[model samples]
Target: MRRTRITAAIAAITVATAALTACGGGTATGNGGNKNPKTLTYWASNQGKNLDDDKQKLTPELQKFEKQTGIHVKLEVVGWPDLLNRILTAASSGQGPDVLNIGNTWSASLQATGALLPFDDGNLGAIGGKQRFVASALGSTGAAGKDPAAVPLYSLAYGLYYNKKLFKDAGIANPPATWSELIADGKKLTGGGKYGLAIEGANNAENIHHAYIFAKQHGGDFFDASGNPTFTSPGAVAGVKQFVDFMASDKITAAGDAEYAQNQSLEDFAKGKAGMLLWQAAGVQLAQRGMKADDWGIAPVPVQSGAPGQGTQVDTMVAGINLAVFKNTQNRDGALKFVKFMTSDEEQKILNGKYGSIPPVTSAQSDPQFSNPEQTVLRQGLAKSAVALPQVAKESQFEDVVGPALKDLFADAAAGRPVTEDSVRKRLEKAQQQMAG
Candidate 1:
């Protein structure tokens, strides 16, 4: 089982949103009060440095919205997992915010909540909608391909970070260009209480991502033609094998590798206890704090040992925050106006730059902050080479099912009794059926 790694850096955004207080009304910035005092309640997920610390960019925008519209705005930031519960709790009681940020993958799930506004042509036009965002983001946010249910906020993707010094010391002149080389280098770097690769073996979502990239290398798809789960294919089996084998193989993973989580793996690599790992672009900054850039370098995930296509898992750390006038909020126009301001190109520029995120809008990619070499490559991958996780309503259940299964597989493999390809395929096939049913 491959663990799908969720970046916890976003936790602050989701956690701070639990606080929502006061609401008031305001006039349109230009026009006279279209209505009485308009109060807009805006909820956002956590952003960088500190949730409160990052408010300089947003509070000003809120004030601007208020001064122009004559509406007072209440701002609340929340963590990831709690965001949905808070929204549901508020919505059920008719006290939800006028706007709320949701995970991009949660777009479909939240849309099922029936509490969000659909970005129809008229509304989309108001905010420089879909056209401004990347196509993948647009695809992820839309339901039935008509229009997006949420506005794109920021974007993220995974990249390979390696210990440059380790590779040089291993008598390797160049980084791996193929998956076989990656494995070979991993083997060479093993021993001395260190690891060659730092995959999150115990994290199932991370496993799925690892499988997805490997399967794609063999021209395999996660869902069959009809969008049904088909995770038992030859390619998928092979992918899973590679993951289990890597952990089980001597010198590849640490003795406690299966027990390690995402943070553990990152710490190991940052401390030079590991050779390489797949991480979001943010890891570059984390590496700088503990290790020098010269000590670590990044590259795209390598191609399959001798397989096909550019198979890399481009992980995205984006969530679409949909703004809707609660059926009970009495301030529909004011709410819509506020959303328009936040998604506008000008504001998006500031958000993407200072927040260390990418705007869904494709145009935002051109911003200098995103123009850095690493960011530029990540943005490109999101469009041309990324594979999205299965965004089914049962996504959480899917994660639960795969997590322990992969842990068991990793343990078995590490003990030199890993599950065979044939057995893994059969087991995953049954799991897919359960998920489908």
Candidate 2:
């Protein structure tokens, strides 16, 4: 899930989330998925470079599960573009996998549908207990003060990744620590065919993520305590404007980046075509792309003022994948067993290690294998400054509406159109209107 902020643009989730109705036949419970308890259908998120890659990595693990439990897991690696839509469909249609992976941010929205098996005290106890999961990770698993709708699997937080060699070549000693510094340093690094920063301008999720953090940096909150949309608040308007200015005014980000939806910005950073990127847990991805670990440095995402911390200095969002079971699965026991197997310390290490994510399971997180510089910074962020996106039931609706709104603003900037606060507020106001409608 890469925190749900670092992946595909979840277009049209408005439709899927709107369609949810507890479960099949408008009831909170209905039978679906594999009929046999000895077998389970699984829809894993596309965490690897591609669907095939995820299949290759997970097959052996699935096989091991089968060998140990005699329950065969039939797997389908679903890509980001369609993962949410698919799950929502299953939740409403009474036809889906018994076990699936969801973006942890979706826990509340899906929980509202009552299609997921709630990890209450008893259910969580059956899956090795709730205390094993990280507290921050657990914070995003549904709304506040309720049993988690899903269990945390892979945990992540955003950070700024910079090319050390590029920095040295540009006579820069350290990464920028503030927004102004980032923009100024970026300007210096923007000559000749290299840009100072790479951005996913057109990706809806990416756009909303940056906006959310920028808003937090300026005392902005996307929703009121009652979960009403406040998208056009002064903090939000400034936040959206400041993020887009990297392209519109700062010129450190390439205009062509407005067309980027795939990991082109990431590719640019990894290939040294760009000097920097704001990302989540990218260590394994960079290494896989042949960039040496020593070639780069990781730091907290730049903030508006002082060091990253609570309130205005908040930087990253709590990100990662969660394991969920469909409420109406016929193979309930096997599904819970599989969840147990996946969250167990052994598999937590293996799966999160391969995916370059921090394990949400506390015992697994302490593994020395996860003690590298990147993981260290991310763990700190998670512990100190990272915030989860609003944990409201309509949170997915927020992403669906606001994310595209930000994408449009980026497009305007890329097209050399005016991107004033008025325009930003108007765009967000329309989004709020959509939410109200």
Candidate 3:
């Protein structure tokens, strides 16, 4: 569900130091006792269909806030590829937005930099308190028992999307509920040169996310409670093997799929060339590409039935964006006020409805628009089984190192090489070593 396009810029210790310097070496605490602030700068993530679309959707909200609070906001919509770099640069230079949008997974990484304000109990009360947010969504903002550096603004989750026509043609009566059934159904659906599954093997971020979910379902986690990597654990090995098996052992996916990115995989599924795809709420995009509403069906991701430590089904990462206030802001009160307004019930409904995402506020989830049939399955998955990525300082490293390692494994499997448990463990172990160093 991450919309990231991998960039070469690495977030290192030096980068964190620069960000801290930019923020004046102190925790952000309400404009240093100045209660009234005039204007605030806001950096928003690009979530609309186009770059300008986000601006259009947010401009009205900004105007509304200005009218209500008498505080004007200077808005800038940043693209994903440049957003991280911009934030880092601003953090180092002490010159950035007063408030900003960040990927939920980046909360821990950015919080470690000491350049963002922590939304502790006292600060959180200003925005209608901690009770306002969905508990699961709020859980992703920081590590266990810590005050979050950000707050949930939007929510998303993964779902198993299948081509209904293809399923009927294959005589499959239902979507899979277990890994074994999924593999078997895939085999039956694969024929006439089309694949049974579409995989974003080349996209490292997408690959790592799937790896995380699969590993968790198998009773393994990428990082232990203390943030040390466990990538080579038995559960992790089993989970990664299952992903690789889609192309290797099960043969439900094509060799070229090893080169497929997220968009390409979605394209293949929409074109009816792949029977199934694991993706977020992508029905809007699918419809734009000529796939009718009735052409596809959505289900929860399958789980490993008998894997050790497997409790309830673990389906997806609590995927979405969060809003954060920068420590460097001179107008902390103004920034905090603006943030509260953005997450209010009216704003959440309008923005989330336009962006095709779920609102992060618990009260907003009850809206009838969110309960539409097209989004029902994904909503159910989020409420029932979705888990967020480990809220660790090394979260980005997990994506950077382990992601590429898994990509290499997928490449090897696509080349018809024998992918053993030993092979998977070796790659994961190498990633663990890199993270430790």
Candidate 4:
């Protein structure tokens, strides 16, 4: 996961200043008419290769969208670290793209600014109504109970990926289905400087995803249906205990793992230095290309204490980017059309197949590769048990706070310091107040 270069406080201040400078009220379009060769700007986050490679993957499809609608799209891909500043600056100044791909967590925050045009129009329903996509995927990209603030593009979900050979070597015939079993397996695998699990206590993104899985397993969450913070509940305590204990427990995660994030864990796992890891689907390719074929395989995350809902995990990156029309776009209709086309069933299938992402639409699951027996495990797991993270516009800030906050608590726990619900609650309460600001 990429770390923010600037502190959240400084970043927020900088973004606010930029937003203030960018503020303007103008017609969605300029005096120039939306005619023959209207160009629509679209900003997206950096994914593969560089802007060039992304453009290549999108050029043909974009051309199709433009040719069909008589509008050309100018693509701009920015790295995640700089994307927030760029969008806020452009949006406040009325200079953003006709359509933009924003991180799902930003939807609520950006939408709350009232700078985006809602697709309450017929365009959203025409491509695929809200019902066509996975409810959790759609929910994650929008204001949870409100009209969707953004359209879902592609999905990502995290799972426990294990070294198959390690399990076989330990005489573990079946994957661990519960926390108890996981610990037992960890004991069997740990030795010779090889730990059983690799977790990211330092990376905020990875921490949030891990927190979600743990909280869900213990039957707690970051927020209730009303969107209030609930991070100190008993379930949350259990979740945190399990997470911290796994890292501190002898023969499991190393005590020094607090300084390591997902990247370190991935490198360790890819190098076969760890027996198991929780990570995104992208790790599949990394492990396959980087490790022996028979060395590793993927599995649903383990459950808590052999309780019901075995092998459950919360899905992140399950949320897809929504292409919102900037209120300042000169071609709102064209932008809307392009948004519809980019998230259409055809385009979704193509992107998901090639990019290793889950399609935003439930029907897109029909694509044979996604529906295959091997892939079906994750698909069904998501469909049956997946919960979307809190979609409150303030979630990005929430992440900024809760990540470091948890790191502090988990680090202490790993170092043999007492960690109680009160300590966790105190930190979370402080974070909640900061986000409220």
Number of the top-ranking candidate, with lDDT as the measure? 2
Model 4 residue pairs with clashes:
22-92, 22-93, 23-92, 28-329, 29-330, 108-393, 109-393, 156-317
lDDT score of residue 404 within candidate 1: 61
The total number of steric clashes, by the backbone 3 Å criterion, in model 4 comes to 8
What's the C-alpha lDDT at position 136 in model 4? Answer: 66
Q: In candidate 2, which residue pairs clash?
A: 3-319, 3-320
Cα lDDT tens digits, model 1, 234-277, are 77777677767777654487757787654567778888888987
Per-model lDDT: 0.62, 0.85, 0.81, 0.67
Best to worst by lDDT, what's the order?
2, 3, 4, 1
* TM-score of structure candidate 4: 0.81
Candidate number that wins on lDDT, 1 or 4: 4
> Per-residue CA lDDT of candidate 4, range 208-275, in tens?
76776687776777777777777677776667666777765444987667878536777777777788
Report the alpha-carbon TM-score of model 2 versus the true structure: 0.93
TM-score of each: 0.76, 0.93, 0.87, 0.81
Superposed model 2: Cα runs more than 4 Å off:
1-33
Instruction: Report lDDT (Cα) of residue 419, candidate 4.
Output: 66
Query: Roughly what TM-score does model 1 have, to 2 decimal places?
Result: 0.76
lDDT of 3: 0.81
lDDT winner between candidates 3 and 4: 3
RMSD (Cα, Å) for all candidates, in order, is 7.4, 4.2, 4.5, 4.7
